[model samples]
Target: MPLWCHASPAAAGAAHSEPALPLAGGNARVSPEVSAEQDEEGEGDGRRWSSLVPELLADILRRVDADAEKWPKRRDVAVCACVCRRWREVTIALVRPPLHCGRVTLLSSLKQPGPRDAPLQCFIKRNKKKSTFHLYLSLTQALIDEGKFLLAAHRNKCGFHMEYIISIRGDLSHGSHVGKIKSNFTRTKFTICDLQPQYEGSKVPSSSCRPRLASKQIKPLASTGNVETGKVSYEYNLLKSRGPRRIRCSIRCPIEEDTEIDPRKAKKPSTPGSLVLYNKLPQWHEHLQCWCLNFHGRVMVASVKNFQLIAPAGAGGPWGIQDDDAVILQFGKIEDDVFTMDYRQPLSAFQAFAICLSSFGSKLVCE
Candidate 1:
């Protein structure tokens, strides 16, 4: 059965309320009550719709896909996918991945790499009382608070290091967790571990499996093992110079290879390659006496936590970059509880969110 069919009544109602079809002049809105009635009527006649010709169905879905290009409305595409198996197949074929489209229309997109040409704009909301952070895709504008929920993380102080557990669901439960970021006692060095290996033929590192083995909540999930996919280290300020913090990230990513080989004879895939990123240097404001980077108004507040990441010249092979100076990823403060995160190719939403989590606690030595 389709997942949508098994959803709760509240969820089904919410989905039904959104306009699935565009009228000749504009969108035709539907009330929840009316939509519910329509859904019942559709269900009774499911056989009629299921018999739609493949070509005609594909064309119809393509039109819907093009018409609803943004969220709320884009959800119409998902609605189409849930109607029947035929519609679902057509929708999947018509919808492009985040890497090519730059839009995250479904839950699966969260794990895929971002677009190569432009950065995917997103935001983070922090709950200080709960020590939880929610990542959202910016729906309307760059600084707007309204967004589509993506992933979430909860911070826990475990012994000497601080741990941020990243999950697809807001609850941050072990079952939903995709990965975690752990920091050292001083909060200067950190490691990112994926619950499952990201690349083909890659095995979980034994060293990365130790910490989770001690945790009751993570032990069962980590039985298959966890892999250390990346490391984030804040540069030490030996001189204690007064300026913004400096950070470098080394991410293990899949190396591109031809995909036409027969599976029966194919050998193990090549080991993943590393993609490195450096924090963009900010200029000193003589009058303000603070460091600044041009967020182009995306960021409103002055904060040491604000920084943009750029790939060094010629370090763009893994990211598919033609412009060496382009910002691969950028995060900044908008309000005390709100922040902006924009990231492009070579970094999945998971990697980008984990890197930003490292910026949370104080790094006295670097600050």
Candidate 2:
């Protein structure tokens, strides 16, 4: 049995032997003799573990960290840290390393930053039965079994286009709707616009709750939009991949406010401040007969529905050279019908979400 499974027999015996300090007549007391015996046993149990040399404890924790690198096992490492102060310190030391990077990184980073603001974590869950998908956001790393009820996107199918009804606090039943994401036939481009603001305290929309741009249109401010007209405010473009059966995608946001197309240009002209999201395409395996994405191109067995957003390395268009070290956003598949998203500075939850939606559906039109 593992050390964490059950307490030492001596500790259990000590616990049972201790006198019950009960409150009676608004007073609580314990016999001095029993209290002293309890104290001695408690001290003995503490000393047994605490007496171990710091090096030995650290060695044990290092082994634990190495062993729990997978999904379910990783959760155990989190539980181990909560055992006691000494264990917590050791775990923190091993998990977080000194770094001179952005304020945020993956929680699983061995050299993660010290406790600061918790990074935003989002997951995509698709419901094939309903022909719909939902996007969820949470502050802590969690498995779907943990239940995510923060901000969410519920899908509504409309012909060739799909609409994502945005709601907050799990208001799927009767909550006032907040916004909608409309996906076009190209299946790459999407526009997010705010619906009417919910009246105070009522689940029903106010009489003015038309699907128009509210007085203050609400969307992820991370990526700005180029054009705004009535209820339709933001417009973003999802560029098609260059190769067939490729898992990669490119996104351009806040396209030039000027709508005129330059027919003479071979490629789309990138606007001055336009941002691009790039997905590193995954390769197909001959033996597995399935397309996959893996870290560093080695773990080919794992399915990868993931990508990263990057800015041009220098002054260039969306298709220009990319910086090798800069990673603005990171997202990938975590489990069946679920995916994980982690982003650094300048990327808002809403912007991260819009980029992720471009990942859905097949890009190959002819098969």
Candidate 3:
């Protein structure tokens, strides 16, 4: 029997034993002693109220886990666990791999894969210019966080700050150099190049943004690059949107060296790698007055504050088709200004990060 259960019988006895003190009105009377015993029992009941059956509690926790996975950000689980001791124990037992098991504050916490089994946690702070962001990538789940100046970007002197140069570097002691990324902005397109070191010393022409071609001619665009290979690894292109605040994306490998020739064929032809496309553009919300990214055309949230990257359905075989729209990336807002990015395999930490960074700048120019 529970502690509250033992007190319940005593409370009933106390209520019966105490004599009623008659009042001046009629038959109504006050039983102070009985009331005191009942009050004590009520407090005990309050203490035991949360002692629900373990199986039922576990089921509730599973629902919470599912909801957390559905969220663009992973902090929902952390918030659920923080409710009370019972909830904390339940969540700790139910949450599985890839789910962060630490306390999250009102600061941006970027969770990516680390060298170790644990996921890397990165915090970001955008500079006042909206041109640069200070990043801190941690080795452990918590502790010893610092300012390493991981990345920065300078917007070209153009409307919308659409075109800019992004640089990713090592710490001050480690060389102070890594690579650069360039974004091409146009009337109907936006493109991000693979990171390359050669771009570090290249100067932007004073009239780079000036219109040089006739209205009907399309201008050629340069690709941005990274330092790891100094060559184009991947190219991400943003196509013209059909309507306001909407866009589509396509990603392809920079080099397509995979070629094969049959004995009867005259020459071997190279085929490009599979093309990855991002669509189902988010819509502008009338009530919120902001663009909302819809998950499965169901759950919707402000796009500027948070969004996700998911693989389109039907690519996988018949058995795997159900999970076609699975999430590949999750971005969420922690504070008013800070946000996080989490991505899965086939994408390097840098690559996943670059994709998220692409979402930061203005898109109205392309529309």
Model 3, 60-153: lDDT tens digits are: 5566456443222234444444434675566555654222333221111111121212223454555556456545444333322442333544
Model 2 residue 197 lDDT score: 30
Candidate 1 wrong stretches, greater than 4 Å: 1-50, 84-86, 197-225, 255-272
| CA lDDT, every model vs. true structure | 0.74, 0.44, 0.40
Ranking by lDDT: 1, 2, 3
Candidate 2: worst-modelled 10 consecutive residues by lDDT? 228-237
Give the alpha carbon lDDT tens digit for every residue of 1-367 in model 2: 0122112345434423444322212244422232456467775344343344778667766665666543334444444454455655665555432122222212223112111132345566777676455655443444344533334566776888767665543445443344556766755456655443333443443335423354844333222222311111112323433332222223333222221121122156424344444454456688987555543421112443455544544522332224444555666676667776655433444445655655655433412
Candidate 3: minimum summed lDDT over ten consecutive residues — where?
105-114
| lDDT for each residue of candidate 1 in 136-226, tens digit (9 for 90 to 100) | 8888775965787788999999987899999878777656777899999889999999876234454444655444534444333244446
Kindly report which residue stretches of model 2 are placed more than 4 angstroms away from their true locations once superposed.
1-119, 131-148, 173-175, 194-273, 283-304, 315-324, 362-367
Model 3: lDDT of residue 337: 49
TM-score for each prediction? 0.77, 0.43, 0.39
Top candidate by lDDT = 1
Pairs of residues at least 3 apart in sequence or in different chains that clash in candidate 2: 97-111, 213-231
Highest TM-score scorer: 1
Q: Which has the higher TM-score value, candidate number 1 or candidate number 2?
A: 1
Rate residue 202 of model 3 by lDDT.
61
